[model samples]
Target: MLILWTQGDTNGIGSEVILKSFHRWRHRPHRAVVVGSYCMMKFYEKRLNLTTPLVEIESLNDIPMQEKTPDEPLYVLSLSCNIKANVGEIQADAGELSMKAVERAATLCLSGEADAMVTAPIHKEAIAKAGYPFQGHTDFLEHLSQSGRAQMLLCDIETNLKVALATVHIPLGKVSETLRASGLRPHLTALANALTKNFGIQTPRLAVLGLNPHASDNGVIGKEETEFLQPELALLKQDFCVDGLFAADGFFGAKRYKEFDAVLALYHDQGLIPFKMLAFETGVNMTTGLPIVRTSPDHGTAFDIAGKGIANEASFLSATHLAIQVAERRRHLETTA
Candidate 1:
């Protein structure tokens, strides 16, 4: 398997975490390449005093066509841009380079040049400053892949806790209207298919978190649960083994997430707040419903500790492992089919 990792932001801890994760993995079973500026990677390697050998390749075709060893040098498919790294600062040039890396990685994956992609943390504000209209990687990748719909799935490898968001990177004020307009059936169907195809769950048992406080307290607080959610869930039961509209607080507090194969949260924070609290170091964010495999560390660009050599790579490692697992599973299913 070959994985293409995108250099998130030259000004953030993206380079630090990528270098550290590769260094820590002594016995490599797969080939990995970084898609970004070679100069930026070299700068981090020297500044952090790491011994990982960096090799710059002209294109994806230049990658060595053989099994990689435990001590294999990291290959970088350097982009055309020449952005300088300014640690702990947000620069438009850095943002432009990071997004360019992402775009190239997506193209490689869709073209079958790469098996999977693992993205580093990218700053939302920086990308905006760069004049891109994307809110985050999920939407940007969706546009690149031209997928029907993209959903964000956060997973914890240690505990097998997986949560998928129905609505992502949207304002809280528009969540209700968006849900009503788009409907929940498509998101639920997509989540179920992703579990079966990506994670290899034969018959996934799923749960959903409510959009209202206390699940609307039986319509005492809000009508979303009774008016919209319940009706959709009732109709969806015939096609899926899903139960939900559970109050977010009690469901997670009581450890009910373990009972289901995966939980679907209506909005972003409804799922991420609890997920980050439980698996801050091990969380892996994956984009489902895309034609190609994609995963990233759940955390963001830590500018405060960008150049301090203290950023943890646990989550990035987890994301790498998950990407490999999913890619292999998809390949297996393809061959069998």
Candidate 2:
């Protein structure tokens, strides 16, 4: 598979991790082409004291149609942008370059010119200043492809853990008022299909977390579980193997997630805190329910260690491998159909 990779914010450690990662995976099984500014990559490669051979190409068609050998070099589909960024300073030009790379790479995936895409960590505040009002890659890719639905799936394979958020990018105070059965039913349904298709589970077991404290503690603390969550779970039970209404706190504390294929949380932090805690450097953030495959490192752009050459590339490399597996599985599924 030919993977289209986009470097994220230059101010952060996105480029550093991307360079450090593929260099480590010198014997990569598949071909990948980086789709960001060439100058930025040159700077990071030099700063990180790396000598990964990269060939600059004008387009994906420019790559020779042949399997890359173990000793072969990687390709870089460098966007013709001369963006220069300070190591730890947010630069608008860096934001724009990353945004442009993302848009172009996603378009290639949508056009069937590329098999999949693995994006680097992007700085939300910097990208917003670049004039794209996206919350993150999930939102931008969903909009870019005009996808009907998008779900964020955070997975840690070593831990055998997966969590899908029902709501994302909203304030803590607005979570309760924003959730609804109408919206949640489809999200959960889509997530179930993802677990089955992507994870290859014949019967995917799922758990849904309650929104309130102690899952509302029989109405002592709250009733969203009684009035809202329970009803939705009942409706979802007909189509899913969901055993839900678990309190968020105790569920993770007791490690109940081990029994389920995936956990559906009502909001972001309710799911991510435990995920990050267990797989801080290894989690893979995947966007499900799109026609094309997309994945990213679970962590964000660490500005503190942007240019210190101390960034870990485990998550980024994991994301790339996952994208290849998903794309290949999807192709086989389609061909056999």
C-alpha TM-score for every candidate: 0.98, 0.96
**Model 1 lDDT tens row, 12-55:** 88999999988876477888899998899999999989768999
Candidate 2 lDDT score relative to the true structure:
0.86
User: What is the TM-score (0 to 1) of candidate 1?
Assistant: 0.98
Model 1: lDDT of residue 307: 87
lDDT of 2 by residue, 1-337 (tens): 7898888887888888888877777687787789887777888888788777777888888888777777666678888656666888877777888888899999999999999999998887888888888998888989998988899999886897999998889898878888853446876788888987887887889999988888888778877877777877898798889887899889999999999989999899999998999898889999998889999999888998889989999999888888998999999999998
**Backbone Cα, N, C clashes tallied per candidate:** 0, 0
Q: What's the lDDT for all of these models?
A: 0.92, 0.86
Q: Choose the strongest candidate by TM-score.
A: 1
Shift in Å, residue 96, candidate 1: 0.7
Candidate 2: the clashing residue pairs are none
